[model samples]
Target: MQAFAYVACAHKKTNLTNLLISFKDVSIRHFNTLVFEDLNFSLEKGQHWALVGNSGSGKSTFLDFIMGKASMARGEAYYPYFDQHIQEHHQDDPLFNRYKLITQVSARHEFRNLSNTSDFYYQQRFNSCDSEDADTVSTYLSSIKVVNPSGLWTIQKATEWLKLTYLLDKELIKLSNGETKRLMLAAALIKNPVLLLLDNPLNGLDVSARQDFNELIREISESGISIIMATPATEIPESITHVAVLESGKMIIQCKKYEFKPISFHTIGQIQTNQDELKQLLSATPSVVYDTIIGMEDVSIKYGDKQILDGVNWQVRQGQRWALTGHNGAGKSTLLSLINGDNPQAFANKIILFDQPKGSGESIWEIKKKIGYVSPEFFQYFPTGSTCLQVIESGFDDTLGLFRVSGKSRAETSLRWMTLLHISEFAGALIRNVPVSIQRICMLARAMVKNPSLLILDEPCLGLDVERQEQFKNLIDTICSMTDLSLIYVSHYQEEMPLSITHSLKLEQGRVV
Candidate 1:
């Protein structure tokens, strides 16, 4: 389709603005895994669209294609003639500026995923080439809210975004996964693309940051720049003019601005689950309080100079459920290092698991076998490229399938959990292929496969939304009922707490308050 003057584009076009970006019968694949096929979407100058789907649903891959970093193997991605055509007509027309199509994937991976191959003078993975003018770039950086640390920087807008995302303290060469994700989000917002194509814009932001992002999205969309974004589940702004639903990489439904959302699918909208009643029911059952699975008396842990956990006297009673709630830097996780003594490499102050002091004669591996842990950091240490099932199975030994010998029941055990989480379909899928939400379920399944008496979850809902959170709580409640598992749950949201936990262990400023 040729360009039409803008009348809200997408068949609602009454004005003569040209179609800025449109693709037909498009299909894309990442190496061997097929992301999506026969996918068709279009964007005009003023429309705001949401590409909503679950994680591993090729949302980011779609954005990659639009950004010119990914290939279109089986369809046409037609860009409307603007500056190139305008030059042919009037070489001096100011209205014919070249359209730059940028997407979130542009800054996703600095290690190798970046399609731009032009080498820089000074090479660093995280820090890019310095801008043409250092002082000038510094001003741009500050606009994105970066206070230049060195005071010699120039025109580096992206670096400021990285700072705003809390990457300022991290070295350019040593960016963590979370740091990288933050960098990507910051990059997309700063570029101000004519038609911004975002894939899971809320991927790495916190709850409050999400509210900030909502404001940012509204501001950008209000500027009439246009946006096409994908999300699993989030409260979107009222500015979203169109919505599309996809299943198994196929477009199941598509609707116009006003005609959206009255239609529903069976699996789409369902109360599905809420385990608060079961939590209360389980709370009534008498807890064994099995002789202090772990204990700490006036224990204070000092790392170099900073004392993370100070004057900490606590107990992990056998078969008693408890949760640790605090802010991000608060000692919830550091306290876990105090509780989790299943491994020798991990250390803390006066940690005693199962009545055996971790530093004593007890075998660390055996202790690990009795204590199940699920955390985002744990998943980070897990086999990076393993399939979801492999990661889940490895939890039995806390190794990458090395703790135990070759097994016959491993797949069966893993499958049992994969089915429970509604993620059996992703058993063979690579961990990196799925979203963090799915990976978290897989991580929880890995912990569940071992069936430990003491289960420690460190922010188990790292990337889960309301739907997946309910699914997880249901499974956890069932486990609490069927086994003697005592939960040491950690979370930021009280709403996510399963009332099965009768004990309260709140932390404030790294001290039990």
Candidate 2:
């Protein structure tokens, strides 16, 4: 209910070491297991620290501790503030009057103090009643280009964020997951608090957006702001001068500058099979001569008159990889959804799938056997507790993995694919504990195990490093040569597109304008 209480913002610059955000004997637990305990560390101004480990290794839980969202088993957080007004008013008053404990949360879109009771959080969470404060959140969202200026504050921006995080794009009452995260940031950076904590703010953004956010963090740090961020990958910019590493509630490493040994980035791609034999396997079916596997004919999808997809016309076929580039709110994702049969009614007469008649009971689902997807929104719902091999075996079920996979041959084949992807080392590991890049490989292996006929990759390369991307490209080539798959690559950046893909279908303003 209080602004800046859960997460504080930047104040004036001070010596972070002297400023003092000290915690003593802090511990947190979940059920029987202690998530973290006996942690003590100090964060100062201009210190950047990366918290790296496997998934579910208490990273998100650690962020929760600072936000005051999690219950701590034991510990105390202390900050120092010299208040001249308190000195003059009542020298006998407790020191608590001068110092305030900063909360945990990351700041991005609108660097402002946020209150839970405000309509911004309340109305957005459960959208039946309009929050009196909806105007403020709406105004901020409008300014940041997340929503339109002249619309219902609670309804518009709230639904868009819901959609981005893979919720139903209707009323917020229908939210699916356990609380939605934002494409923007929590509004805590404006509070000017003594301590600042950021969760993993860089997880789902595109590569270009990552660079943009890094720049913003640098600007904040250079102005003498104190920041403590938890991330699996060490992305310490030159701005970060100190670090504190926490593991199992203990300070594993703390230093003025935590130097992670730079492992040499190596490219991993192999062509043990003959290129000629591989070429025959990768060839597309020569029966279809249409330049596009699918085409949109002056398609105009609208919400009333405001067209989400304008009269768009485009062509896409095998061997072509179009990045589907666009700014946020540019209707890129909307178009992809339409193609994937998620919204068939939205554009009935104007669209075609693999040259199939789109409207007459035809959908991308009819050709579902041919497509494979990797949207960030869709990927999160994928079951992750299963082993790398078990889930891969379930791909034969063609149900985004199934609960019961019993065939020994399928499991053996799945392990073979895991070996092919160089993930045999983790064949026994849980998907929930692996890194994003590894999880992606697992998913890719799942998709490729069946050798889908027309692979439709929606932002497939997300979370992959340059090495994996290269490895993936070769894998795609090998698969294409091994079977008949017409690849459809969609992304917002041209650079992320693999050089092997040569076709494109550009969508602007809903139509192919």
Candidate 3:
């Protein structure tokens, strides 16, 4: 339990004088499952590492092991530099090593209210009044207690480096997915740890932000802080010196950055879905045929003095596919919230959904029944206690979690969608227990279970591997071909979009560009 237990003198034969971390013959267990075994990895003082693998390949678990959060069944994980720090400052308190020597910016983040309680819901982000209760970005960043201030990372420097200066006054709960990612990185930098861990750091960022982030990573590496990040193979930054590829709970490949070859993704063929199940689902929830799926006219939304969307005009029609393009904080999410009936400000603007004007007698639930929605923000706040089956079933009623008991038909339909998505094996598994990629697949199945007429996917492929991304993209194309489904897809990577897209909308600073 002490930090010294993991610290040992470097082997004379290895001669790694500047080693920061070394894992030898390591075996890790999560519950009864052996998640990692015979894992050997090392990090030198100047080396930055990238952990690349498919979904559920234990990439995140590897990072957790380095952070001292994993249960090691056998072998030793030595921390030479961190041990020195512990010996110098808190020798008796080994448990504080993780807090003092390491900081991790994960893909998921949670924000609390002003009262410092996490009593918020998924829909609260769309409700302006409720969002105000959450801490502002500036407050959240300032609240971080820097353990080892090196004068290298201040709040000002972190914000400026991450291009987050304009969002300092915004509420934490109201920021987009990419904005939140930047804020989390800034918080970690301010802590000034000896090692930084990032899990899929570029998953939610737009193209420009991703480029900026890669540059920042290079700068950070030069600043003497070691970084070990779990990322897709294609996203490995040039700052990284080494690459480790994991598969099925084993480190399969380890080599220098220049020697690593990227994995090639083949063209995915059409997905074969059960036509009877699709027909039954569509018949059960017959969508009213409408020419205009969504209509917005000079719509403007503001939270206090901050303008989220300014005089934006857009429209979508039946059987049309749209690719929504915008950088972080460019009002893409806000615009989608209006169509999905999540933002309360929709009533104050001139908007239409499925031919019904905003503030009409139609209930939000009625409007939502015809629209399938998924986003990174929704995934972060989704209730995780329900099983995968239950999570998808709830989508039929457009609820966050399963409430009412589903009958035979709904259960069958949910199972059908799960099977099509290759996730039926996890039907009984709790959503929180699944890998992030599987969780995302479950959400996609949930969105498609009802066979809704309109599908709004906001960065739906954030954490998927190359194979899974191709499969999902092909599935989207197949679904569009078979049904009259209208689509509004959003992704920072243009390659992730399906071939069915027929229109594009670009937003810059809340205005159509």
Candidate 4:
């Protein structure tokens, strides 16, 4: 179990200079099903490994094992000796102090669930609140556990290195996804972790944010820190030195990055359709004329001391789709909130939803009836107790549970949509027990079950693997082609945009720039 390595490909060999981690004949089981059977994996002192896999391929479970959060039924795992070996024993050595796993879900949880914020922060967008009283970015950074937090100079240097100096005084909640990620990276660097384990770190970032993070990863690797990251094959970073492909909980193949090539799980062929076929598939009517569906004039939102949106003007008409683009903290979510009637600030803004003016005193229920919304946050709050069929049925009333009968016709329509989405087998299964990819499809089915005029999707493809993403993207394209649904799709990943999106509105620093 000591430091050792093995030969790989000709050019992508594992250098045995120093071993960081090793596993022999590892077997992991969940509910009597083997996740990893007699699997052997190794990590050396200075190499970047990409754990590539599709959804439900157990990539996250493998990562949990590395993080010491997953227990193996049988296996031999090894790590380097730490200073704690003297105080107690090698078994008591802390493995995570030198290892960091940057996951997409946990980052969001930290933003929403972990942040200790005041009610004013969530309820209001603008007010003469004390910025001085807000917890500054620097205060949040100091909370990260580090070996030498007293090293203020080191922390300051890391801050500048990550370009977070301007955000030092900004409230943590005000920071965007990319900004928060940078802050987390700074904290990881301050701890001087020798091995950094990341899970889909690039999933929710825009092009600029992804580039910035890529450069940061290169810099961190250059500083002598080894990195092991997990991402789908389609989204794997070019800097990866080695690659491992997991299939059905097994390491089907492991090789050098240069020797690696993608293996597609399904043949994604071209979608073919004529005008009539497209209309029938999407339930679209070509005869419909254009009309305004959403309007915002000189709309502005301010909360405490921060301005989220400023004098923004936008319009969405019938049969027209729009893509919302921006960096993290660009007020994309806030803008959607205003349209969805979730934010009280919407009442103060000059906004119109489905021809109904915001200040017109429209009931929340009435506004919601004409619009369908889906997001990662919504998935977290979706009712888990309901069956998949029941969940889809609830979309008719915009309620979490099935109270009133949707009628036989409505029930048949929901079943048809589920079948079209290839999830009919799980119709009776609890929505909570379904895989995330399936859950997304179910939510999408529910969103479209009512066939509302407006659809708001916020990062709908965030956690999906490459295969599921492609399937979902195609499904969205089909939805757009066949239906007259006006889409306000908000996503950082431009590649995930639906084919139906024709126009874009970009936001920068609370302004439509």
- The numbered model that scores best in TM-score is 3
Residues 440-510 of candidate 3 have per-residue lDDT tens digits of 98998899887788999999998888777887888888778777899999999999999999999999999
Residue 118, candidate 4: Cα error in Å is: 13
The window of 10 residues in a row where model 4 has the poorest summed lDDT is 119-128
RMSD of each: 9.2, 10.5, 5.3, 6.2
Report the lDDT tens digits of candidate 4 across residue range 1-513. 111122344433444447677788999765345678898888876678888766667776787677665678998977642323223432354564433422222323343323345322332222224333445688767766654334332678789877788789777545555666677667667766656777677756667767777677777677666678877675567667788877678887788877766643233443232345334434522333337788999999987676889999999998788999888778887788788776777888788787768878688778777788887655544557888988888888887668886578768777877777767888988875555667777888788776678888888887676656777788777777767778888888777888889889999988998
TM-score rank order: 3, 4, 1, 2
TM-score of each: 0.69, 0.62, 0.93, 0.79
The lDDT values for all models are 0.59, 0.53, 0.84, 0.69
Question: What lDDT tens digits, residue by residue, belong to model 2 across residues 1-513?
Answer: 111111121222446446445567888764334677887755544455555433334665666565555667878876543244345544675754532335355322212323434222311322224322223433443343211123222334343423343322323222211122332332233333445566665544544455666665665565444667765344555565554444335555555543443232122343243455334323422333444566777766654334566767777765455556544445665666566665544445566676666766654445555566555545644565678787677666655455783688777767777766667888877776565567788887776665565566766665565556667777776665455457777665466566657655665445453
Model 2 score (lDDT): 0.53
Error of 4 at 267 (Å): 5.2
TM-score of 3: 0.93
